[model samples]
Target: MWKCLERVLCLNCAFAFAIILARTGASPVIVNGALGYSVSLSPLTSVSQGIDEVVWRRLSPRMKLARCSQGSVQYFNTNYTNRITLHYRNFSLEIHDLRKEDAAEYEVITATGNTGNEHSELFQLKVYGLVSGAHITVQGIFGICNLTLICTVTSGDPTFTWWRNGEALVNDSTQHIRVLGNMLEVHHAAEVKYAVYKCEASNPISKATAEIKLRDVCKLDTSDPLPNSSICAEFQATRSSAATGSF
Candidate 1:
């Protein structure tokens, strides 16, 4: 009978411990970090006096990052050696020289000695590359309808934004303008003859802008013969002009 009673007590204690853990759980907060940069994960609640220990951990592929107790800090995991800092006052964790592999879910647990209570906070880290080399490329004839200007970037996952005459452009069916992901299509090319168009590409870390002028791209050579001229003569004339200019 005593053995059965002891078993019942153990089961009750296990159930109570599960409830305590559930109450201390928290939703993960998203934190954005740039590659090769440093980012800090702050605790949701301030560390109070009489707290005995603070433990920082990475959840996935579980690893203990650091532990603090009695005004002393202990570092774990050779992967994070010399790259992490634990602030005593606030118990915030700072990771330096962030890498793509550093993106993961982190947890901070604080335990109070007197009360034997523990609280935990979670953070989800996301790393992004810097935006660079953004430029605009044109398609179709300059004077023709359905002209398209495409925004291209050399690196980074970026969002595209279009601007015309310094004003933000959006999808306006009335104006015959469409703003697709990285392409800006204008059904009426004449409407933009005197306007300057700009394409801005950006990510969480950086941004770049490129501009274009329709007049410059569509400039015509005044020296060229009229459209009515014979094709054979036009080719010969153009070759002769180029030969004379070489001198």
Candidate 2:
């Protein structure tokens, strides 16, 4: 709870400063990165109060600074320049051909038009890499027509892709993935149709996918380890039997 509040406060403060800079006709900019995402940094108040100069810095493993007036300044690290592009008008920095090392915090500094009214705001940049190790399962039955779908990724990026019979499954209006960590949950599973299901992890450079085939309750081979089941002991049999009877 405290951590959440801290984040909110920090965001609000950054916004307030951006507002003050806009009102003063001060240069305000937002620095962030995106591969498939289109993000913009808007002056929180659109009123540049006293800010005269705006600067954006990339802070990850090392500090790379860029000036609003000058396109690029001397950077402590050399790797960022080739991958980073600056947009001074909106105070944004776009990272191209992202890499895993690009994940970290960034900064924005504003100098007020007056002699000594300067302040700085820091923003965080996270680079998501290619994801891997995905599995899918079905559970939670409501009726002959109701069920649930669950997709799990053991590691890698948070993004997930659900496929049925080797084709991408279209999520329904009522379907949503759980944002708690990286778990993907879909409610209201299909009633009778069963097929090969897959979850693919994606990032900038490559993708890895895991697949599982779902059979009917009558044809499902409970004789073998429930696909992807880690349980190797007879305990799996006992547990499966007990649960099957109850349901």
Candidate 3:
């Protein structure tokens, strides 16, 4: 009898869960959030009326974030104790000061009555960090005047772009310009037409650029058969500092 009773209870729970899933018919909305920023998760379905109680939860490794009922709010997660706000009217949630770990699937459940029926909405939050502290380094081969410019960043995953004289730099075999990932190589440096080179590092949230003068870094006298290593060394020491600015 006990086993039969257990099976009946399991079936009841599954039926209740199916109803909740049916109410949350739409797929989770994608929401991009930046670190140390705020993001709002609003339900597509209107909850202005017939909402007795509202609960917000993180889906995976399930944990309650906040709850609202009878015009009063309660927070459950200690980490987000003072950082989350719940809207009583529409049953929406606003999270502040987002962290990397906050990137996850969230669900808002609304209860209308004692009929055991609940309406739920899901949202997928992706948190990204702002790009910053970008710099460039220059290196040259001993015999040839070929030079490679490398852009490095102190934080954030970013895409790198190379520019010349405020224009986008394109790869051309004839011009000896090659862009490889974060490194830009200039073969036969003297033959290159542009003087000022810029490397821009960017992400979804922000971007930064670092500029370099060709004459400043490549101070070698190309006319001479053998370039002076001492002069190159001196230039390397003085121009080692990268020129950086935010955009």
Candidate 4:
């Protein structure tokens, strides 16, 4: 048995200790899944001369999930059934329909029969629910779309992605668009006019999207002189922004 040096680590803090682990290199396994999503954990070497056994364990609960030897795999934990598949060709552990309880550090220990040597790999799995109330608001101009599109989600952790007409949005000054965290600054470009903007919030297991076409949501007439109209000032602002080539 290889002697174990005990240390506590969370995935978020794994990077600080990545260079210390030579067997797994300096890369931290960032496996995140939303609730009810699936994730896989694989050993560093898929094609090693391992003739003995492989063990998969969850460090938090000290639960042995699977054991494989001589190409035969066994599940010691009944909590996993169709949810796990060791036959995934890469000697990887696959867990399906993840639950929050499944979040923990996972370790893969392999023993070589001929050399009587054991090697280990460690990583953390974080599971969370999807973001609720995923929506965007337009603040600034109207027809020119030169406005700040702020995306708001109930959850603070899920990654946020912005899309326009099914295409992912990128922050390029040439394209007159900028993405700053959850806020998207849009300029009136050929691609920005009247296009639907989608904000997607997702975790490993859950994904939610909300889209809004500001043009459709706010009707403005540049010719409308009525100052009392809610959108009249927006139109005036759009005209002013048009000089900046935003229109």
Candidate 5:
């Protein structure tokens, strides 16, 4: 394992024995749900008051992941209050129904509940997007029509699901979408059907979604807004972790 070190000086200390602080290079520390991403510093300690706030802000000037303060968690500012899942136990933040706006570098701040003295670290998060198209590609012998829907999303290990008229397409044979190289193929598509097809792509730490509407021969692709329920779940799950800056 590769390692790096940082030192702190307490010149006026009363204790005879010196305290040593060694820091390794951003090493791999595991967090829940996020597969490969790791915390640079794991198992951080706080003074007697315990932890108070955990704020994950974009490294730059972009929107930040939800933050947990005191006893409550908030999302995307005020309008999204109580819409985030927080895991304060481990200081981890999870944002569900992620959006493109959520993409960017992030700073995680941890503070002592009583004194409010804080420490923070930064991380980078990238959001992925998808492309989709659909049309009446074939016509049956009688009046039947075969519609094909094609969807392509970025990033590896992306999961694809199909929806029609806001209903999840559960039948594998008729309304199934095939996943291939970040692309989804739907065979025997319905003609003159009006519905929405959504592709949600995510890694353990971050998530993004893309949607397309099927209407006649016209195809419209758009980004789905972050859902309130998903945001709430993300906040609650990560609140504890965020509060303490733990695994």
Candidate 6:
């Protein structure tokens, strides 16, 4: 809990400092990247006057990425060879085709020409991959008509959204629909008929989807007709346009 609070306080301080700079007409930028994408961490505005040199580093691990002094930019060690570049004028660092290992804290420090006072700003980069899978499964009550649909995945930090027949599925007070995390619970035979529940998972880079065709699972066989419930009729009439849905 203390670690969590520290992280929150650290982020809050970062944002507060950024806002202070923006208010003073010097707004630095934080860059977020994804796997296989290129990123550049540059200041949106110029640094303070009398600044003569700049240095960049991975602030947390204290790894030097680049240095800019006397109008020249220098890359550090071989760990960043061929994949990192530094801009001499502003000391911005360019990362080519980002990877998970590249995620870390970064900072740019400015050296004053005469005032002897140094200023610095921070930039933190986070890299993530596209969401994968979203495999859905039906659990229990194959004959009783009550069920739960579970959505799963293999990788990536993802946010999930639930859909029913292409419409957003929210909690229904009648106990017919219930959504929690990646699970969707259904009760009543009418709720099980003529519906399709879709689970969409997404990360910074891309989206993936999976679905449960209620008509297929609810009915015993393809030859069997749909239930004659009013709710089922309504769902059938409002068919979803998810013909090409894929995982």
lDDT of each: 0.73, 0.48, 0.73, 0.65, 0.43, 0.67
The sequence of per-residue lDDT tens digits that candidate 6 reaches over residues 1-247 is 9999999999989977865674344443545676766778885335446567787888667888888777777888576788888776556778887788888877777767786546667777877765675677766544456778777777667777788778888667346778887888877464354677788877655667786666534555435453432222211111111111111
TM-score, cand. 2? 0.42
- Model 4 segments beyond 4 Å from truth? 1-28, 128-133, 137-247
What candidate 6 gets wrong by more than 4 Å, as runs, is 1-30, 47-51, 170-174, 191-193, 216-247
- Compute the lDDT of residue 39 as modeled in candidate 6: 78
lDDT of 5 by residue, 100-202 (tens): 5554555567777665456655555544432222211111121122334444433344454555556655445344444443344544344545445554444
Instruction: Give the per-residue Cα lDDT of candidate 6 at 134.
Output: 62
TM-score (all chains, Cα) for each model: 0.74, 0.42, 0.68, 0.51, 0.33, 0.66
Mark the regions of model 1 whose C-alpha exceeds 4 Å error after superposition. Answer: 1-25, 171-175, 216-247
Best by TM-score: 1
lDDT of 2 by residue, 67-171 (tens): 554333333346756655556555555555655566566666666565655555555554443344555555532233233455555544556566655556544
Q: Give the C-alpha miss distance for residue 59 in model 5, angstroms.
A: 3.2
Residue 56 error for model 1, in Å? Answer: 0.6
What are the per-residue Cα lDDT tens digits for candidate 3 across 1-247?
9999999999999988888676676798887777777878887556555677889999987999988888898989897878888887777788888889988999988877756568778889877766676777777753466778788877767898888668787666336678887899976455443367788887656676777666533445466664443334321111122211111
Considering summed lDDT, which 10 consecutive residues are worst modelled in model 3? 237-246
Ranking by TM-score: 1, 3, 6, 4, 2, 5
Pairs of residues clashing in candidate 1 = none
Candidates by lDDT, descending order: 1, 3, 6, 4, 2, 5
Error of 5 at 12 (Å): 8.1
Output the lDDT of residue 89, model 5: 61
